[model samples]
Target: MNSQQPSLAQGLLAGQRGALARAITWAENADRRFPQLLEDVYAAVGRSHRLGVTGPPGAGKSTLVNQLARHLRELERTVGILAVDPSSPFTGGALLGDRIRMEERTLDPGVFIRSMASRGSRGGLARATVDAFDVMDAFGFDQLIVETVGVGQAEYDVVGAADTVLVVLCPGAGDGVQAMKSGLLEVADVLCINKADLPGADRMVADLEEAVHIRTAGKGLWMPPVVSVSAGTDQGLDGLLEAIQSHRAWLEAEGRLQLSRQEQRLDQVQRVLREGFDHAIWEGRGLEGYARAMIKASRTPHGAAERILEQLKAALPSEWAQVQEETQP
Candidate 1:
């Protein structure tokens, strides 16, 4: 462990809010001390139920999340919220910050809220979102909610990381057909039609219900429930919460919670490995010069890429040689 890591880990374990914030910052920046900090606190993770909220930009996702957080606190549950906002073009930090609207909960000691910039990361989440969630979980929050920037269909990555994914859609926002077209239904554990009192809300709900039914009819798969809510009026919020709880109960009863978490952790491992490889091979090993040299030799980009792959394979340990040979055509 590094010099500052132990103290940080101890402070985090002691449930210090400052420690939690700093730890998340370390995760966000990919700081050098983060790995050891995580290692020291990893065992405390997995206790918090991660809920991911995402959808179209005007879906009222932030309002719904605020309502949900308020309701959870009413139940005496400690909550940690990571709101991933769009990046500022220049600073690469959260543009709206949105924390201003969450002022009610901001002063509540039981609630820990952080806004992260998308930082040009795709899949509706900042690359550091899960890492921050893990640290928040280790800090002993009973529930953690992740709200994505809701850029579009590609934002499904955040849902994959959560225990339950709530895809919120408001009526007349391209209609429910757009949801189906964008493949949003495929990732929804619970489909929340917010602004339920709107003119087309019922039609939107019906469309989604039919879509979910058709998609899961013969597969014996769990069909995501379509629930309606008016976050603005605080109406039907209970039904949304009930749907989330029902899904959680189903996962628990079917013994699938651990399996799902394991899969998410595996995905995290793959992401971390890819990042590490990019840093090690491209930056540490000076592979950029080699690429430039190959281009200077009049090689096409694809040809140069193949040459680089060969070099990478050659540098691998002897144990991989036979496997590499067998895979080569």
Candidate 2:
């Protein structure tokens, strides 16, 4: 702890566990040392396989991740999980109840589970998540799982980071397949119809197959497989894991893995810039004053937002001007 940044970087590169913990803490706090932490951990990058699990709520995403983590540990692989939970809009505190579902693994030395509050940071996660992944990667975890806020198109951000994104969907929800069709169906590298014991499992699987056939049509990519599993019963997990391994094999065999990595790198850069710019806008004051004025004058938040954004735009870095222009109507 007494050492300076260079020494700390050396310690981390040497695989000192203490330095890894300190680095993760610093990144989570959004400390000024973050960029340096990433720099130090750069050599450790590309060592971990990033897997993202997503889907509608109640699709057993957490359970699937837990199962996968245990499977990886059995292979002597260390695992890190970033579980994104919704924050209370009123209090900014997270429910973070995922711990209950993962009680069996709490004592496992090979697994590290971290719950992150979405923190009003939209797009399915806090901006610091990629940094958090870097911390875990540098800490020598062999695999990392990022589980995003369920539902909504924005949650597909996970796909951008993952080598393979498994979209979990289950039967019994009134509109489960419909919900999948909306956005979940498109980005998924693997589709799981969980709770296979439930009624309509066959129907859901058939629906998903048809959806994939239509979407991918002739792309010649390994068709995203539709898997059925009953997580509660611990059924079909091995097959699910096999499917994941198969997808990874296909990625490597077809040379898409490197492409995925390249896309992920570009995505991280864009996301970091976007979040930094948004944080700057929200820093000095709450938006309450502007909201109140808009309500009083009967103007939409959209109009006021445009004016405020124009003001914020002038001070933005030139690179962001391109982003602003592309987003403009």
Candidate 3:
């Protein structure tokens, strides 16, 4: 809300890239002015297709995403790329590997690429990644590609934020077995066998196809297609696009897209509320110091936490009961 700075909400509505950048920074920093900007620009969201790309390290995700963004620009689609990289522990900043590799796209006006630090988040994404996505969507990008830090089976953070989850795997990694054990196959809307020119590529593709066939068979579920692509050589990119489009069509059928988005929105709301309330109780209300004092007096950490919860319940009886009931499994 600096007087010298232009109104970010107004600038975002006007499609100014500088405003978009600043707004995303505000999201990253939890700036006080962000809520107003979000309120002003929220109606412009929901038009872009969010595609989440994730895989284990060394899977060539950045290369594939660079190629995809270039192709999208050729098709006249404005693209926003969020590359969430592992944070440097010393500085809590992005490694910038993905941004360095995507130098060509930086010059293109249609492609806005931002590199984000994961900041020790386990789910493959930075905490503010989804907030940045919303601002980019409001800026009128036709597509938003969120590339996660190379992730394992359990770090499937992109699932809730993306409309399509694209799982990328390369040959010679034993990723096929890992995918099954990690349940990567469960969250994937499309699977890409990247580095298709390498050895074992075809075998990996076949194995994944068989896996998909088995898991989806007799359940009437949407079978995630296995696509083989050498993004390095730019081979079979069109087929990848087709596979994604087919999934999009399936999701669009019978209001499935609407329902899925609604559920994800609800999840986002719950996460935000939980985080805010926890912070308010511990930090804002001086409970953090009290917890420490209780620990010093021989109370276990769990016991201190239970005492704090009891205090909160006493203060807001009906509200606390509703929260507990809603959170019950």
Candidate 4:
């Protein structure tokens, strides 16, 4: 946490590709120096395109991400991949098997890859994914691809952090259209029918197109185009890349790109502030006092939360005072 340490983190943030990998490591761990490192990373960040890839399991998101990285590298862009994997139930460690799918990029100096374990976070993305994105952004990567652990519909937290979101789906997945109805379909900037060579691929595409049309009936914004690709054979990659770039162009033309980035940064600030408040509330002797209060108010959980918030507001730093007004009930 010293000035020298943060200076070193800043140095690493500015280092070539190796700096990206190191930044990811620093962001993922809960080191005490993390806050300072994050500040340094944010201070050095610039305009980097962040693409979020999400879908249900078996959607071939990993394959798509690998292909996308290769495509970006071909275009002479420095690429960073943050692949989110679920933690092993027994070992409590990430499988980290994405490296196998991304073998082609191993020797590519322009590409940096890191695997993160979800740790059963509610969003199916590790809490540090956004921080890792900023670190990569600050390290001068032109493109940062965040691949979510697409376990369920709610795993679509990537949309808030990404400039363009690709919701990848495999053909013939049971009730594909129904899965999108809950909200995921509405958030997609692009829909990818990965593994398109499989049977029912066409049907899935048709169904998704109809569903998207039906859902966005009144909205004038461009409807998300569905692109089919067989990642195994590298089919339709060019079209997919074109679709991704087209969405970026659309966002820029519509003036949504800068808006999206601003929203994402503010969202992160809110989340960080909430976490700081929560940490301060639970630190020291308050945890024991809270347990006693909880036991006394067994029938109503509200008592402890209300009391905690009041205490939190009173103890918060001056900067947090401005946030407490909205955060407090």
Candidate 5:
């Protein structure tokens, strides 16, 4: 741990907003001190119920998220919102300022909102979004809502992190067809048809419900409930909230909440391992030279990769080598 990490972690645990912000920034930048800070505050995590909102662009996701935060606040719950925006190509910063709509909640001390840039991460979420959520969780928010950059198919990461995932769609945007064709239904715990006042909203709802029914049929444990809402007018917001609450209740009743989180943590570990291996082998170990040498020797890329993997395997501890050998066919 660094000299300042302990104090930062303490401040975060004490509910100091500045410290929470700093910790989230550290997570965003993947700072060296973050792991230590996370360790220090690890006990405080897992108290918050995480909800992820995701969909295609202009689906009123931000509006719905803002309204959800307000609704949660009305229930006397402390809310932490992570609104992820697409990255700017040049500066790698958030392209859209999502905080603009969330201005009402900004002044409330009980509500904390942070905007994160996707930074071209493969998922609609920023790579560090779960880390940021963890720090916020440790900060003692009762509810944590992550509003993903409304990118279509690549938004599955949010589902893996959140306790409930609301896939928001709206009329006149090809949203219904896109949601069905892009496999968004597979990831949704609740399907929200926003802008319900529009012409095709009911038809969109019917299409989604049929799709959800067809997909679930007799196999899945939970069939996602489709709800319609006009976030702009705040209509049917209660129904959306109720659906989320119902899903959470179902997860808890079925003893799957903890199981889901355990799986998510394992996924996080895999991502960290991949990143650590990439940095250690390519950057720290100067294995780029090995690749160049193999190229010069007329070795195929796959052959070079196999040789590197063999070297890596050989360098493992004896116990790991035995385990690997035992696992191999």
Candidate 6:
């Protein structure tokens, strides 16, 4: 982040919290030097387990994440939390108020919590979520928790970014049926019924357990474990941890975890490419005026888009030619 890379990259590996926060800020802002920072810390990436906690709004994801951070801290594991929230319409920036929910954890030296704005990204995840996770992972956190905006049922961004996806549901939301309808069960590695102290919690748990059994029966796939937890009272924390550990153990066996991580990295690569190209074409090279002129000349939208792509393709490095066909839409 400076003239000397050692000050930033080495600082991160040296366990400096300032370096860690600055590194994540570089990611959030899409700083040009971010690629270099990543190169400096690439060796430390892939060491942390990223847990994505998501569900419908008001499912108490922040409180659950708060408790989960404490749980991991009790085990003496360092934790980094990324809470992605909806962008403020006025500022187009993260409304940092959500940080208050995890305020207690901030007092602990081992825990780092950052609130990010969704910035209109689909599935309630910021486009930079993966990058921020990579930075946090490189900073030596044993565990990383990504808490989504919890906008709704379509949260595949978490599924792609997190190694273990915990879909949190609660009672009185009719979330069991909602989860089924929204295919939340399909993406979840572990199903958590939060607010277990509330009425109808038992019935909700039973329903989800039966659903999981029914869905995975005879499929030979890892059936998602259904666990209920009352984050407010801290009940069923061990059960929740056990369920998560069971899934993690399964992923670790037979190199499945490595395979899964490779797939996730592939997704990250595509994401980086798309965002990079979008920025290059639309934000630089005067393509906006070119596009406007072409459109004003009565060119079809698709035709103008094709010409822009042609310009981009021509400017690309020769080494990228082989992959052009596959990458092009």
TM-score, one value per model? 0.93, 0.81, 0.92, 0.88, 0.94, 0.90
Ranking by TM-score: 5, 1, 3, 6, 4, 2
What is the Cα root-mean-square deviation between model 1 and the actual structure?
2.8
Q: lDDT of candidate 1 vs native?
A: 0.88
**Model 3 alpha-carbon drift over 4 Å, by segment:** 2-6, 293-299, 317-329
Cα-based lDDT for every prediction: 0.88, 0.79, 0.86, 0.80, 0.88, 0.86
Q: What RMSD does model 3 have? A: 2.5
Top-TM-score structure, candidate number: 5
Kindly indicate the candidate among 4 and 6 with the higher TM-score.
Answer: 6
- lDDT per residue as tens, model 3, 7-77: 87888879889999999998888787776788789999899989999888989899999989888888999
Q: Tell how far residue 211 is off in model 5, in angstroms.
A: 0.5
**What tens digits encode model 2's per-residue C-alpha lDDT throughout 74-106?**
888888888988888899887897767777778
* Residue pairs with backbone overlap in model 6: none
List ranges where model 1 is wrong by over 4 Å: 89-93, 318-329
| Candidate 4 off by > 4 Å | 1-3, 89-91, 290-299, 310-329
lDDT of 6 at 317: 91
**Model 6: lDDT to the true structure:** 0.86
TM-score preference between candidates 1 and 4, better one: 1
Off by over 4 Å in 5: 175-177, 321-329
- lDDT, candidate 5, equals 0.88
Clashes of each: 0, 0, 0, 0, 0, 0
When summed lDDT is taken over every stretch of 10 residues in candidate 4, the lowest stretch is 174-183
Q: Write the per-residue lDDT of candidate 4 for residues 71-132, one digit (tens) a residue.
A: 88889998988899888767777777877889889898788888899765667678778888
Model 5 per-residue lDDT tens digits across residues 42-138: 9999999999998888898888889998888899999999998888777876666888888999889999999988877868898999999999999
Q: Is candidate 1 or candidate 6 better by TM-score?
A: 1
User: Any idea how many clashes model 1 has?
Assistant: 0
In model 2, the runs with Cα more than 4 Å from the true position are 1-4, 7-11, 14-18, 175-180, 277-329
